[model samples]
Target: MGHVFGAFTVLVCALFGVVITANGITVDVNDEVSIKSAARIVADGLMNYYHGNESGRIPGVFDGGYYWWESGAAWGSMLDYWFFTGDDTYVEVAKEGMLFQVGTDWDYMPKNQTLSLGNDDQGFWGITAMMAAERNFTNPSSDEPQWLALAQAVFNSIALVWDSQYCSGGVRWQKFVFNNGYDYKNSISNGVLFQLGARLQRYTKNETYGYWAEKVWDWESTIGLIDNTTSYVYDGGSIETNCQVLNKIQWTYNMAVYMAGAAYMYNYTESDTWKTRLDNLINTLDVFLYGNTNVLYEPACEPSASCNVDQQSFKAYISRWMGATIQLAPYTYNTLFPMLTTSALAAIRTCNGGLDGVTCGYTWLTGTYDGKYGLGEQMAALEVLQSQLIPYTVAPYTNDTGGTSIGNPNAGTGVLGSQTSSATSQTKDKAGAWIITCVLSAIAILTSIWMAMDGKGEAKKLQEWIRVESNYA
Candidate 1:
């Protein structure tokens, strides 16, 4: 048959769109029910990965599970699931990850990963803890070593890596490792820092947090990692290249992470600069990562053999980051929500309902089942589905203009901050530029008119003088 049926499509034919089975749930793409079901499947799948495993660490399908960053990503994703749904089923997984990753001191110094724990690796754990701190736990606060304190410790540890050395002030990709990609300083390492700094500033109102946020933001501009006009963020550079060379690999996660960081900082400071940067980055992201159909396409990977294992999980971050961006910058609702919803629907449409749970495929564009079934792919799918269910809340406005910078979270409007688009913000920016242009043009025209009139008046005076001289003669 020319019409090859997906798992949902086949089930829809028999049941007329009504079923939520343990094997898998099938609902229309737009239905929020789909989001809930997907979240359950993803959480269950994560359990499957760790069920009998002693390490309690998720293995990376693309690389080694012991890779600290990927493990950190899994932890962060779990925490996100908790925050997104306010569910505690995910809390144990997240808690285990937080405690397991810490060194004997309960800090981020992993003994086995000391040589490998670069800025980005540690930053991922910090990101997870940051979320946990925000939730404060819906269940009893029984988790050891308080959430906020743990995040603060990791943030302090990461601060030690900042260098005035190469790339003009970013932590290297590797710390002690020599010539083993240690010379490079990538965006993920710094982008996570920017995110952590912005969020900390939002929560604590500490000036130092704002300072770190801006520092990383400025550093990217100085090093040309971000294109001034195009707003495209490139891969990092090696020391041998003098930080002058850049790898033009534009991964979806890089842009997503930076946009998310910018969005959070914008919300934290309400700075026009951060707002401008966030708008620019979002526009640029649309240019490179999203297709006209409103689905995400890894520009570098999709046209060929598909993304690698490292890249397999990249879209998950992008999806979750965009979800966070929508929460942080209500201005991005128009541009981001449609893309996210459409992409989620496309992603959900690809799930192959079988005994292994609703395993999703990697190719979102075709909605065709991606043959390579890995933990990364499932994690990626779960993230997008979870993103669809949660409605981001904006901090409630306070009458105290001079009050602390931290807005009151408990007093939220709960308005599902998902309407006004970033394009509106851009329009306002353009309006200001337009007003200046109009004023300048009017000034130039008036000056030209005055000059012409002056020239004519001088000529008439000369004529009058000539007439007077002739009469005298």
Candidate 2:
């Protein structure tokens, strides 16, 4: 049976000739069997990056350049894989990894992750929890933290820190004051918050989540981070500059997160405002789609080969969110399905890398492997490939519509206590010492500021340096 189906897939691909790659995986856009076959191959390559299932390794994590937050994102992709294909292979590992990281507070703010945790980082994990709930994946035991509660916890925790002191109101890139880019208010942080809130609203029929989602949209638009005219979402800006100067780097993930948020809002309310926002966002996505080919590309860093560890896996979010948007707002299928098909075809063609012959690459427009491989590249291809199966899958579930995850409206309302791990406790102790050091350093810097101000040229140069340093995306 396997040989017969494989041969038939080859014949269909040859006859349709929609897309072909050097790798063993090939897909005929019109054939579900072909897409799933190719997706399974790509999924194998994606999982090759995972070592979290091994003894002594952290659950839900990938080794090498992958950060803590990306592990969460990867599991989210795996959940989509399970939802789309009915595959149970990865479910146990993903569930263990996620449950292990929910922290003492039942939120995703594990003490070890706190040193580098950004609102965006925690938000990614929350998004994954929401996906699990929507997919009706295996539920936790009665005492274990539920998926809906975890999502709500993340939302509540992040929502408390919405800084009104700068950028009017937007979540900072980093959750802690000590982290780099703490002064930056980036789109991904706020976008994730918005997307999470939107999902929560749909799931629980909670208007408070809906209200916060609207507030984020209004602030993003008013601050011009989301361009009202072109509908292009910029990377972010510094609160130090009062967010007056934008970084202006157009990242695919930023747009994709917001697109999902707007789609969910529209789906829940059926209002024209959300409907219009969704339409404009989709219409403007052509910017990331390389010219007439419509294959997704990272505009800021792909051409220059400067994409950082985080930027590399950005397409995974885009592909995943695009699938979510299609399900949320079914009207979008006509406009987005062709783009997804074209992009998926191009994406898999770049998977002919590594000894396994299915390792993927970052740039899909090249139509060949770029020799650059990571969790991001493999995930990007896997998402686009498996997302082709979304149309045949059931729509995401809601509380009233068969969702079973339990909720705790106050899950994230209080301070996060330390977990019982000795390693986590030691890390918190180190963090406390660092905070004191930062205070002393701030005092010393303030003393130098007066001396520098005495010389006009020196003060002007200092201002320029600060502006440039804080402008990072």
Candidate 3:
């Protein structure tokens, strides 16, 4: 695969006596595009009609059928964008996609969402709806059946897959015990449940959620699915291996889903164990997943063609949940944001014209365009770019506990003001006005210098030149 590299100069700009550093300033000229607009372009390309249906669910391949997991991942990231930035333009589209996936019981089942056969896959849609659940959605679906209830039913389905037969307890990859992948118990399925449990625990103060949270964490921790030594989450253990050996593929989302789970656990329990575990997992990511230029990447398939359709969307959660963890645990801001910011800027630079004609790709490290366009690629890119919206996103949520949230004091409004572009003619007009103001300010300074020189005639000439320049502007 060919690679594309853009020269980036990371800047730590101090505005009004406070230092702002979440997704630091990148000198990549392409960075000037509107983040929201890029997200919309990505959606337009990827969320087209799939399987001859007119739903907003993002397709897996270009003009192709829907993959339950990928579409869920895309919706999750899109809602994250709306939540993270408080921009609701994507809400209607996200609602349609989400609504299409939920079954009659509101569970994400194959009866509704296609190929939603695996427990982990169903868990994805449930977890995606939780984002809506946490917020007060004014839409009809928000109250039609209650988003949290939907999330709970999905949780119920995922919990049904737990088998003590494997390492005392772990979720089967497939729902049925007789299925081919049923013997496989992976991190994502179980980890998402742990995440849901923790979040529900925090939101509802229900000990039942806490119970499940601790149960899954205990099982994963005890079985070494999360390496006790390294804290990196291994893929899964199969019945073929007697659930004794771990896959240890180390996908970015496997680690991140756990990071997010631990973060919610921290918010709910404030337990040092969860904090320590989350910290250790982040350290593991730094060592393993942090790649060229200290940006995020999958070790097995970057700068190469090995990453399959499913593997392409892994980092979206890393960008989403890692940012979420920061909201819940402010102590991690300095350590995590710089790396995340690099990846975010890399994503923005990958867009065709920053905001215009954006088609995001799966690979972030290449020096040239990889030319792969699909729902997975767009969602992965959307995740990183939307992550830049975290500073704004975290502020409102942090207020949940109290007015003062755990983050940079001025981060929310400051960084958000700097990063957001409206993607309209109004923005171009503002740029033009700023340039005119700058030129006028320069002219005024020059006029003052000439007056100090005791040359009235020369000052007049300077005034005429300034007037001519303004007319040209």
**lDDT by candidate, in order shown:** 0.61, 0.79, 0.60
Ranking of predictions according to lDDT: 2, 1, 3
User: For every model shown, what is its TM-score relative to the native structure?
Assistant: 0.74, 0.85, 0.73
Candidate 3 residue-wise lDDT, 1-473, digit = tens: 13333322211121111211212222321332355555555545455423324455232212454466767777677667666546677576567656656656556674644433777887887777667656544333322434555665666556544556436777767765334465567888898888877876565444555677788888888888888887878777765555687766677888888898888888768889889988898888764433346667777665456666777777777888878888888888898776677676666545452223455656666522356656677777677766655565443221244221111111111111121111222343244334433443454455346435743232111233234323322
Better of 1 and 3 by lDDT: 1
The alpha-carbon root-mean-square deviation between model 1 and the true structure, to one decimal in Å, is 20.0
Q: After superposition, how far is residue 339 of candidate 1 from its true place, in Å?
A: 0.6
Off by over 4 Å in 3: 1-66, 112-116, 139-143, 288-292, 353-357, 395-473
Greater lDDT among 2 and 3 belongs to 2
lDDT of 3 at 361: 55
**Model 3 TM-score, all chains together:** 0.73
lDDT of 2 by residue, 1-473 (tens): 33234334433443478768666777776777887778788887778888878989887778987899998999898898888878798888889989998998888999998778999999999999999988898988877888877887898778767767566778888887657677789999999999998998788776678878998999999999999998899888886688999888788999999999999999999999899999999987888876566567787777667777888999998998898899999999998877777778777777888888878877776666878999888888899888888778878998777887776665676533322211123344334324323443454455346434543222121244345433433
Instruction: Tell me model 2's lDDT, rounded to 2 decimals.
Output: 0.79
Q: lDDT tens string, model 1, 33-84?
A: 5666567766676556553234543332123453567667776677667666
Clash count, candidate 3 = 6
TM-score of 1: 0.74
**Backbone atom clashes (below 3 Å) for every candidate:** 2, 0, 6
Sort by TM-score, best first. Answer: 2, 1, 3
